[model samples]
Target: MEVSRSMKDIQWLRHRVGQFLCVGFDGLTVPSHVNDLLTTHHVGNIILFSRNVSTTEQLIQLNQELQTIAKQGGQELPLTISADQENGVVRRLPADIPGLPGNMALGATGNAQWALKSGQLTAQLLRHVGINFNLAPVLDVNNNAKNPVIGVRSFADTPDMVADFGEKFIQGLQSQGVIACGKHFPGHGDTTVDSHLQLPTINHGRPRLERVELVPFRRAIEAGVDALMTAHVVFPAIEPKPIAATLSRRVLTDLLRQELGFNGLIITDCLEMNAVANTVGVGRGAVMALQAGADMVLVSHRLDRQLDALASIVQAVETGELSQDRIDDAYQRVANLKKARLTSNRRVRPWAQLIEETRTLQHDLAEHAVTKLRWESPLPPSVRRVAVLVDERVPVMVAAGDNHSPVLLADALQAVRPDLHSTVFRFPETLQQVRTDDLLAQLRQYDFVLIGINGGENKDYLEFVHQVHAQSILNVTLLLRSPYDAHLVPQSTNLLALYENTPWMAEAAVAAMFGGTADGALPVRIP
Candidate 1:
């Protein structure tokens, strides 16, 4: 079929190609560069990070401004605004927003309904803020205990458990009008490396990949998931080369689209990650991602990189490096999704009512997720001198999305013990520092001690726990992050796993510490 090459047709094709690019920018409001991307460059979608979010009103206003800009830019469809509101620590919302304890927390409860409810509540929260697309419900089966990034973000270690929770979560989001995307297909749960820092390889054979890693993603597709995000890691079983899955035709197109039968929007992970950028470059990575069958190529930060991606896509089509049919197919998918979800009349719920409802849900979920592993030691009585130590390291995994100081556990402990002395120390891996003798010497004066561990993989953190046990003082340890740390702690220690460091999880841990109820179980086995 011969296509027209007139100026009007070329402009239309440019607009269509731009729709395949989901870009991000700094700040809460629409910046001048981003405005140029939408108005002049015809970029049609955006992804919001913590930097672009603040209060509820501010977020709504900002989204409204983005839509206004898109409309004024001569685009016919409403822009699909997205955020990583994954309901746990990975969420992009502010601290005040009511949140769940995250996927592993929900998995601890062993009730798939909570996953569904969390998804529904998350959808309500996003829809109320004028955000329609939610990049969430991580379906990765976290089988590897040493996984550096996916730890508590995943639902469970087993494929069936992850699939059960993931299917319901997807149902929750799509039913409530927000698009839920199952991420990092075929899976990122077994990796020891962070894709943001470097590209990792999954060397599993085809049978192993189908049996373990591909289970949740297969279920997600069967459950009618709205979209699937490609991983940046290399899968040699699916794609022979060392190329990441995001730029692999066999992985993204043959396996995910053909074999798995997923026909929804296929979005690439941020092309700016070292996995893609350091290797093929973001511009070329974007072109390769599209050619590999990704419906949308995301360049999440840096306007220059985004522009580079846009130009690369245009040039690929102009030079016949990319087929016109392929570009049109991707555009049609994006347009179809926009018409179905974005064109609807979306009315934000009443603010007071929404807040109260979400808070109630959050509290219930936290209570259900706080697991009491074992309490060999007696609970602390009314002791005057008490020392509280917490891992003050920012999350080593960038996907954890925690950039601020962690004070939730400290604040919660302080509320209970008015005279409690708290100490915050950096992780050994974070600053190449360890727990000091001076800190332990100060703890010797206290009759009882409470320790919070977030960096369980760090040798220094585990060593500190061993040291605290040597003191023979009564103590309790809370695994504030991944519960896998429970194995690293002393066997005789009283331990609790909260799976996340949110305020709700902190309060639940404190309640359990003070002889309150924490009946949750471990979602993953400690090996």
Candidate 2:
């Protein structure tokens, strides 16, 4: 029987190469190209995105299939299935899933315990869905007001605030046996450009970076975070070159490894992003990233790009351009992480009840984070004839597959004040289509005007807000994404930054408007 079992063992899988390539599957069903990568190369880790998800059942089946395929191919250790479940904007989980308020909401609550609960709850949900790794707890200190990407996704503006929440989040996730990866290492927080679109350069010197950007990363490391994801931004202060952090050995090996002393696996942000790919293509970028000490290269989105990246890395190894020792070291590090973090047997819970419990926690965070920015005169107006105008740019998440939740301020306010008479105005479908004269006339009908701006970076939204401000209408601005938008609004505007337009958060913010309890500290300073 022993001889027969030995004979039945798979052969091709045992010789699996390119352990550094941590690629993502294509879509809802695993494509042939993806399977070929997993089977031929024995790629151990697979990241999931929203496009790949439809329902929980499908996701669970996909995860099982991927793992079974790995096992069948003779790749021993369990394949690490990871997802971006950092609720609020980065959530890949289905809309029905218990999406927690984002990091900024957690930060605004000013409670470490809540953040810990968020992490633990998020881990439990992902584990149930057969996911072992969660790329979450965005540890970047969002100090820049003009930052396009790391808005409400970040916890706070200050290093200490982000550190406290991030550490607790790591502790909570790891305690439940889910690997927590602190993301966008060396900080992508202060960039005006989105890394997905292009390479953002951070001009902060060592002292400035140490004071803000590196603070949360260091804290996350000290708290024993299992993984650190690299940012694609160029740190001129550290590297003095145009090379992204993903490709800079000086940034990754010297700064992060030597100075910060991070021993955990260092994963690169998606190589498919324009920042890296545009400069050197995803294939070359992957090799460069691995050479720069990245243990895993995430080539997400395009399967062709992913395969090309894997082939490039393999070639680099074969040519001695990337030493075998480096490959082995990365493999060992990733293997150790998988062995420690992957749950041999996950504890099953009543799915319905678990979601319910998580939803309760979400409510707690939203209520506590609903802060009162200005409390001068009569708040929660005695006469509630409210008018809400939402920016046309505020995306409906269900349709866009984006993390941003739609602005439901009108509904939330109506929920809080049952007798309140309110109407919501929307911008036209096309850009610059909303009739300014008609909008102003409609606003003039209401006692108090409420303008909703979604990400706050759109010039049209800002233009509208300025136009409204010019009218001398008693309108208060509600920033639905980041509080930093308050900087762009008129100084006289009574802005209420909800951080996220999540349902519970919208309700909580509206409650404050109607005198419920506008009760959170400003996480980021607004000019």
Candidate with best TM-score: 1
* lDDT for 366 (candidate 1): 84
Worst 10 residues of 1 by lDDT: 426-435
- Name the top lDDT candidate: 1
lDDT of 1 by residue, 227-336 (tens): 99999999998899999999999988898889989999999989999999999999999999999999999989998888899888888998999998898889999999
lDDT of each residue in 248-310, candidate 2, tens digit only: 999899999999999999999988888988999998998899889999989877777877887
Q: Provide TM-scores for the models.
A: 0.93, 0.89
lDDT of 1: 0.85
The residue ranges of model 2 lying beyond 4 angstroms of the native Cα positions read: 1-18, 377-385, 394-407, 414-421, 428-441, 455-476, 491-494
lDDT of each: 0.85, 0.80
Model 2 per-residue lDDT at 221: 83
